[model samples]
Every structure is written in structure tokens, then in C-alpha cells.
Target: MSTDLIFSDATKLAELIRTRAVSPVEVVQAHLDRIGAVNPKLNAIVTVAEGALEAARAAEAAVMAGVALGPLHGVPFSAKDSIDTAGVPTQRGSPIFKGRIPDTDATSVARLKGAGAILLAKTNLPEFSYSTETDNLLTGRANNPWNYDRTPGGSSGGESAAIAAGMSPLGLGTDLAISIRGPAANTGIIGLKATHGRVPMTGIWPRVPRRNWHVGPMARSVRDVAVAYSLLAGADGADGFSTTPLRFDTGVGSSPDQPLRVGWLVEPGFGLIDSEVAATVQKAAEALHGVGCVVEPVRIPALEQENALDIFWRLHRMEVKPAFAAVTAGHEDEMFTISKAMLGEPDTALVDFVRLEQAAERLRDGFAEYFQRYDALLCPVLPIPAHAHGLAEFVINGRTVPATHSLSATVPLNVTGLPGLSIRFGTSRDGLPIGVQLVSRWFAESTILYLASLLETASPVRDLHPDI
Candidate 1:
């Protein structure tokens, strides 16, 4: 095995495989070995495709026989347990469907395979993906590889942990609200939640109800993300919300640090921020200032005046609840207690839904106004880095935090369907990785990613693998 492949990006791996310097089977084997070694410790992947290697061997033979390869070519990646893969357990982290397997790979999964990326395993997620920690009755818990005592952060926690610990270079993750961003922030890896309808949501679970969800890439670098996003973006006729993919003129524009405008919101948008989270965000603001961007204290004008969590609940109430309701029918007692506590709560009171819709408009308008003056907004991904495992409550700075939506600073962006990127910015005094999210205008991920790339260059935090 080449020492280079251990942590190499997809771009590098593709080129190596293209040149025949690397075999697809070898590349897949390395990821398989990494999963075998790390999954036992972190529990990131719930189901492994045992025959994945043999498939990779076949792929290698095709490459050797002078066949054209897909963009992903020989790379290995994982899908969240929620995505269907033919002949593989597609358990969404619950015991109800223990032996369940689909007859077809998800549209995204099939497309990726058609393009040549190998499906290595299915990473874990919260049961029915209701909580912020990735623990389910079936797959158990996924720990932060950086600090096992802390959570890797939910729903997409397993995806983030797997990438951070080098179990795989790339993986698929779905973000309804903060699933992708929060876990990436929690585990100190790169995660992006695409603009609403940017990626098709055909084969994913729960999309049959909630239409606001998006699927995107989680990986080590911005370029890796670009490749995944390109492959995943475009209308599939199945996802009606997706606009037909058309030519976007702009590439990733640079000049990372010039005397341009940047917004820094240290306050949790509609929640509270702890000292550590505040400090981490402050440090990022200062770093942006040092890099020549004018950082200013910006406010989310409608945050206090709006109930975004209520909006979140409403969007899910009519669309998502039925699917979740089915899950809670028999196993309500066995489910995460918090999920039961939060589920089936009334989302809107007719008048309240009207008011919340107005509020969403105001919030969107506020960001629209702010973006006219600033390039991007910076905030903490979560009020605190992945809270202590499964505690019913969180205490931040001598204040007892409310359970579900208390840590919700990132949900507003989801409502506006903007682009948010999480990068490893700071760690706690105890060494838990804390991340600051940079949000850009809708469809302008390049701006946020450019800022993140600059941060990566100035203070690189890479290759921090788990001891597991």
C-alpha cells in the first residue's frame, strides 16, 4: 500500500487509479481495513458490504481492460444508514427493520457507483434520526474519535467520525436542519448542506414527508466536496423540487482575505452560546480580521422576533411526522426518551403557521440585506462541542439549557436554504474539537468555502486520526 493513499483526497486517488499507479481493489481494501480498525472503536459504520472488495476487484479488472472510468473511478465512500443499497441492510439505526435490504441502490448511490465510487459501508445515525447524538437501538452509539467521552454529534455523526478518523475519504449525508453541519463541527471535518433542492432526494428515507431535506458531501477538503456536489447535483425527475441543473458561470472565486466585509454573530441565532463556543467564534472573527476582512458584529434581526424551531416543527409536522409516527407506534418505549418527549408536539396553530411563515420571510430578508454588505456570516456550529453523551439536558455556563432546540443556531440557515460550511477552528481546553460555521448567500458556497480554505492554510488542522 502506498503511504500516500492513507489520507489522500478523492482527486488524488482518482488520478492515481487512472494512471494505473493504484488498483481499484487496493484502494477499496485500504478503506475496508480502515473501517475494520476504527469502526469497532467509534461504531461509525453499522453495516459493511462484505462483497464490496470483490466488486472493487471487478472494477479494477475493467480499468485494466481499457474501459473508461467514472469521475469517482476507484474511490471508496459510505452512505448514511438511511440511504437504500441493494442486498445490504438499510436499517436506519433501529431494530424494527433488522434484516431489511433494498432491491436497488439509492439513486445517488447508484449514480455514484455508475461513476465509479465504491460503496464501502453504511454509517450509523440516530434512530429515525430524531436526536443530535448518533445512537440507535440497532447500531448503538457513535463516539467522537477525538474524545470518546464526548459525542460525535448526531444524525450524521457517524459520517463525520468516519471521515475524521480515516475510515473513508468521502461519504453521503442528508441534512434536514443541522445534521451535516453539526456533526462536521462536532468531529472537526468538512461538511456542507447544499441549497434546498440542490441535490435530488429520491432514495433517502424520511423525504417522503419532509421536502426541505438535502443530500450533500462530507469529506476532508473543499475540492473533494466540489466533486461530490457536482456528481450529486441535478434533477432526477423523481425529486420535483430540484430545478434542472444549468450552467453556473462562477467557479470558486479567490482573494480569500482582502478588506472585504464579513459578519460575526457570536450570539446564538435564537438560542444561547456557552463561553467556549463564544470564544471559538470570536477567535475565528479575529482571524478573519487579521486576514484583512472587516469583521463586524452582525445580528440575525428576526431571531428574537421569530420562532424558527416552531417553523422547523411545522415543516415536519405535516410532512415528516407520519413516518416517525409509524416508528413510534410499537417501540415508543424503546426509543430515545428525548425523541418521544419531542415528537408529535403541535407545530402550528393555523394563525401561528401564518405568523411563522411571515417570520421566515423576515429572517430571509434580513440575511438578504446583510449579504449586500458582507461576504459571509460566521457563527458557532453548536453552542457547545458535542454535548455529553445522551444526557437529557445540557448546562451551559451555569445555566441549564433547554432540551431540543436550545442549541439551534444553525437552523435559521436551513430555513433560508443558505449554504453553511463547518471547519475545524478551535478546541476546548480539554481538547474537544470545536468548529465555527461560515454561512454564505444561497448558492454561493464558494464564498464560505474560500474563507474556510484560507483558515485551513493559515492554521491547518489535518490528519488528527482516532487512536481507535
Candidate 2:
């Protein structure tokens, strides 16, 4: 019964609790037990919320009293350590701020708790949330539950690992470039990088480059991500960037009035993609077509010309370096590899930075034009499945590229402020998870999320969990 409870998605868990078939205490305790069993092996959860059971007890009392409950009442969710969690430790995977606890919860965390989700734990991340793999001197490294030797992608790596390993049913993860989607793809879970600024970045780190950073949900099912997004996607006044006053719709499994026009791409824009990964993108396109959507292979020339990954690195390094330097000012020795490497890079030249900004505008313009013709874009989440840990470079389709190339497929969405969702659609030749990215125009999270739900139902590898 504990095993079944642990693996159930947040939506199902909420329903079970709502029906009084399960008590809030049982749900929270099952996750706590699961965390105790698997977290030591995965090192995903760094700090367990001491008040979790207390909160659960309160939820149970409410249920017994026949009081109204929120949508996620009694459901346990985790957050990436980079996200502030009130009194809980949010070390940001660095010793510079070790034992740091915030006085207020991040907007994302506060929203989830408002919906009755209990904060269960804080997950790990790369130092200062700035790397492709999850590791830091503060918490060591987060191992993939599928294959301990490989990584669950970074920044959000711990969140993905925790959800995929059934330590938490749903969680919050922040994305900058590839952080959220890459890790979810690595672990066979689903992650949403909602339209930039759709979810407030208040209380998250490194606010200097706030335009590219996003906080969204990572979960085992599409419906849960949609539910979380609906609650999270409004202006929080505190975050200036989150000023979108649009109404959000949790449109899971909903169809449009007409056939949704879709496009898929795997090359000439996203850099070197593995043949297997490329085929998976094609397969996803075929599946969408099979489901009565108009799908075709397409490409955007600006993406190929601007190179979103290059633009992201050039712009963010200049913008974020000072923030890191200031935070690590006297505690240089406490910095880890990812943060140190980021600090080591020289600042973007004034002329080059201006050009990159212009280039980013062009990329966004290009996506705007493409979306006029297509409702959604399908692409590979990563060039390859989760690779072995500590890789500095990767060889894909007979071409060797820097490790940063992994950001190619994802950074474009960040550059354009577009919405994207990562869902497992295929298994790699080596038995690893391969995810496809679904993208839509700005503030159209409902479209991509609805499309993801369709693909989730049509997915060949749906509901497959790691044998941890």
C-alpha cells in the first residue's frame, strides 16, 4: 500500500485524499518513508521539512471536521533548494550561504502551499543553480535513479530525481536555459518551463538575469503540472517581471476548434542531436499526426543564425557574474566548480552584448513568425539521453561539441520567452529516458500543456518509472 501510494501522481493523491479514502497523515508519511528509503541513494533531497507532518496533521483535522479543502490538500511536494522555503534551509547548493533559511517563501512555493500542498523537502542543485549537472561542494552530487553513474540534469536535477524516484509526487523547479526541461528529460518525468515571467521569480537567486529564469512544476503526470501552473501563473506584484494580467486556463486534454497545426525540428537549429534522439522527435511528430493533429517537419532560420545557446551564454554570463561575485565576495573558497567556472569567464564585450541582445530580439521575432503558421513546435529536449556524470564534452551524430551544446534545444525558448513542456516519449538505446519538448507562443502554456496531455496519453513510454 505504501509503495502504491508513493508512486501515485499528485492529482490522484489529491483525489484519494478528497474522497476520504486516504488520510493526509498517511499520504505524508508514505512520502517521508519513501524519502528515507531512496534519498540516501539518490542524494536528491537535501533537507526534509520538519513541519511536514504537522501540516499534514492539520490537513487531516480539516478533513475530519468536514471543512473545505484546496485542490492539492494533503499532497506532498518538494522544491529545488534554490527556491526559498520560509524557515526551511535553502542553501542554493553552495557553502557560501550554508544553513541559510529565508524569512518568506518564494512566490511559487507560497502558491503551492496555498493550494494545500505540504512542503515535504528541499532538493539538491548545482552551486548557485548554474550548471548542466547537479553537484556542488555543499551537497556533493545527485545521482540519476535510472543509472547511478549518470546524471539527472542540473539546477533542477535534485527535483527531477526526487520525483522520478517517487520521493516526491510533484515539485517546483526553476529553469534558466536547460535547467528544468533537461533534468525532467533525464529522469523520465514531466517538467514545464512556462512562458517566461508567467510564474514570478520572487525569492529565487540571481535576480540580475531574471528575464531568462523561470519557476515551474515538475511531476510524474501532465495533469498535475497543469494544476500547479494554473495556481502559479499570475502576477505576484513583488516580481516586476511577472506582470502578465492574463487569465490562465488549466487546459489538459482539451482540443482546439480547428486542427492544431504543429511543427517538429531536430537539426540545423538545435545543434548536433544524436540519431536516436532525432528519431524520437520524429516519432513524436508521427504520434501527433496519428492523433489527428496537423504535424510536419519545420525549422526557423533565425534559430539557426542566432544560435540561442550562444546568445544565452553571452548575455547571462555578463549579467549574472556580478551577482555571483557579490554573493561569493569574501567566501571565494566556498564556491564550487559551476559557480567558479561561471566567474572565470570574462564579461561580454559592450558591442557584443548589444549585438546579442539584438540577436535575441530577432530570435523572438522568428519564433513569433513561425507560431503564426503553427500552434505548437515539437523538438528534442536534449541531444542525447542522460550522459555519464562530469562530462565536459559530448560526441553526437559523429560531431564533437562542447557540453554547453546541450542547451541548444532549450535556450531558444528562454531567449524568446516562449512556453515549453518536456515529457518522456521514448526510451534510449541504452535503456535511458528520452523526452520531447513541446513549445508554444508566449503566454500559451495552455496550448502546449494541452498538447502534452494528448501526447502523454499517446506516449509509448507512459508511466514507466526507474527501478530504484
Candidate 3:
């Protein structure tokens, strides 16, 4: 097959299939071929859906026979191992979940299948979906396609790596912090932590207590993320927050052309950001200006909370003990040291959970009030570009940054339960990808996507691809 097949986006592939220009079997086969050639280098995909070949052929026959097609017709995609796929092993990067296969598909899986998209493979993640690097004992670490010595930031690293390498056009990734956005930054792809509660989280693993978790999209293009998010949005009765009637629409994930009020911040919140990181934020803001977005540096007084980050991590740590006790007990040696450290922390106390909840609420309310005056907030996704793995700690902005857990600038948004995005800005001096974040109000996914689509067309990160 011609290499051109690998460049097709989920939307474009669907359109081509709809027009009968390419059969579903052809697309799926091409992706499988790509995976066969590329996955050894990236170690991104853990399991290839055994019978996708037959499934694609069946979809082709139905399309030819005049059957109605779903919006994602013939698109190829992958999911983080945390998402359940019937009869497929979802190890979730841990020995505990090793050899485990789900009897039924998760809501998102069913939705994608119902839309005629082929499940290409299951991507890797951190053990129990913990940590910021996508590696575990079972699938190993997912290396950055750009630089093998570096990591593809986790826990959604495999998904972003797959899309960045063109192995898959789209993917499903769950997020609480930068699990979606951070990998996109490192891999030079695009990811959306869709507004919490906008997309159904019915089937993701470790099922973190409903504080501020989200299951969202990752793709090479912003438009692909939008398409996936739109197809997956609904209030499934199985989910607690899915209380309202199932409402599925575009969910405003696409862009609006009105002049956008963008607040750009590079204060690093709690961690010390890289010196060049702030300059990149400014440059990205300037790029947005050329596209008609009004950019200004804004102060977020809420971020100044002393010990804010420690408290947040403590809360997240507290929740993880229950979620990972079994896995840690069975495979403690296999888990990342940082993740192990989190577990070693005291269990979440009731008062601590309640206090963290209140603090998170305050932060959200303050950020929301501020966003009411701005179209979106722009900032660095990480303090530095894909750094050496297993550092245990590092410095940023020439400051003595102590904690290994404070690198993520995108984590606060997770605490706020808002929609966040990470799009490539440019590359670092060492040739790794650099990126910034775009955050919008809750459930304002379409607006964020629209802005991303506009920025993509204007500046275009499409040319930056890994050597793999």
C-alpha cells in the first residue's frame, strides 16, 4: 500500500469510505500493516484486536450493500488499555491485570464500534494508569517516536505516540491531569481532556472516585479529537454524573471565529518552569494574535496557594491506594517508584478528602469566574520538554524544584474539572516538541476544538513527525 494511506485522518478516512473511494477493509489493513512495521520501535500498542480484519471486511460489505454508515465509518483508532474491549486483554500495564479480558465493551468502546470505527489495538499506560510515563512490566515503556532515549509522557503516552507516528488516526485516553495533554506535548500530537462529565467514563479502569477524572480524546489533529469527542458524548445511566438524559451533540468542540480573549500565564503555578518555556508561551500567544486572538498575561491569584500542590497530590494519592492496592500488592516490584511512593503515603483521610474537595471547589470557582472575562487560558503544558526518565526529581527555571510530581502545569485544570487541551507549539533546541495548553469552561469542548482547528490551519504542527 502507498504510504499516503497512513496520513489519513479519522474524519478524512470516514469521508473516503463514505464516498467508496476506499473500503473499510483497505483502511484497517493499511493500519495493521503500519503497526506491524512501526510498533516494535515505539512499543505503543499492546494488543491488536484479533478479528479486526474480518470486522473491517464485514463493514465494507455492509457499506457496499447500501447499509447506513456511522459518522466514524471505517476510521481506525486505539484505546488506552484502561478502556474495556470485549474479549480483548486489557492489562493496564500491570501484572495484576495481566491476561485479564473484559466480557463486554465499555460505553466508549461500544459507541466507537457502533459508529463503524475499527478498533485497531489497545495502547499501553502506567501501572494501574498511574505515573506520567506509559511503561509497565507487561508492555514495557512506550518510547517517544521522536527520540528513543526519551519518554512519551504518560499515562496516555502510547495513544499520543501512536497518533504521532501515524499508526492510528485517533485514540481514547482517560485523564485527571495531563494524562491526555502531556503526552500530546511530548509526542507532538493533539489531545483533549474534554470537560469533565461531558463524555461517559463508564468503562475506564481504577475508577478513581468521581472527584475530577475524565475520559477524553487524543489524535494527530484537533479535528480528529473533536470528531471522536462528539461521537462519544452522552449521559450513560451507568455513570453517576450521567444523571441527565443522554444528550449527544457536537458539544461545541469545534471553533468559533469571534475574536478570542486569551489569558497567557507562565508563572509555573507551583513548580519551576524551564527558562525557555515562558518564551514559548509568549511566542504561541503571538501566533494566536496573528490569527485574531487577543492575548494578554493574566494573574491567577488562586494558584498562589501554598502547599496547594502537595494537598492535591495527597488527595490523588489517597484515592489511588484503594484503586491500586491489589496491583501494588501483587506486583509492587513492577510498579514505578514514584507510583509506589504515592501508595506509601498515608491513606486519604475523610477530613483530608473533604478539605481537598473544598479547596478544589474554590479553585474552580475562582478560575471559572476569571474565565468569564476571557475566551480561554493559554500556558505551558510542562516545565520542560521530554526529559530523561526516572530522574526521581529535577529543577526548572533555575529554581531548586524538589518534587518529581510538580512538572505538570495542566494538573490544576483536572482539579477544576474543566476542559483542557495541549497542542504543539514548536520544537525545543534539542529538537523535541514543545507545547502549550488551552483551557475553557466546563463542557465547552466545541469552543476549544474550534480554536485549535483555527490555530492548526494558521500555524500548522502537521509537518513535525517522528523519525519512526
Top candidate by lDDT: 2
* Poorest stretch of ten by lDDT in candidate 1: 246-255
Listed in order, each prediction's TM-score against the native is 0.92, 0.98, 0.93
lDDT (tens digit, per residue) of candidate 1 on 330-419: 877676654665674765577876777787888888888888878788888888877778777878888887656533777887788877
Off by more than 4 A, model 1: 1-4, 244-246, 249-260, 268-270, 326-339
Query: What is the TM-score (0 to 1) of candidate 3?
Result: 0.93
* Runs of candidate 3 exceeding 4 Å displacement: 244-258, 268-270, 306-308, 326-339, 348-353, 400-407
For all candidates, what are the clash counts?
Answer: 1, 0, 8
Q: Regarding lDDT, does 1 or 2 come out ahead?
A: 2
Kindly list the per-residue Cα lDDT of model 3 for residues 45-146, writing each as its tens digit. Answer: 989999788888888888899889899987888999989999988887877678999998888889888889888899988876777877777788888988
Error of 3 at 377 (Å): 0.6
Error of 1 at 373 (Å): 1.8
* lDDT for model 1: 0.79
Which residue pairs in candidate 2 collide? none
The candidates, ranked best first by TM-score, are: 2, 3, 1
lDDT scores of the candidates, listed in order = 0.79, 0.91, 0.79
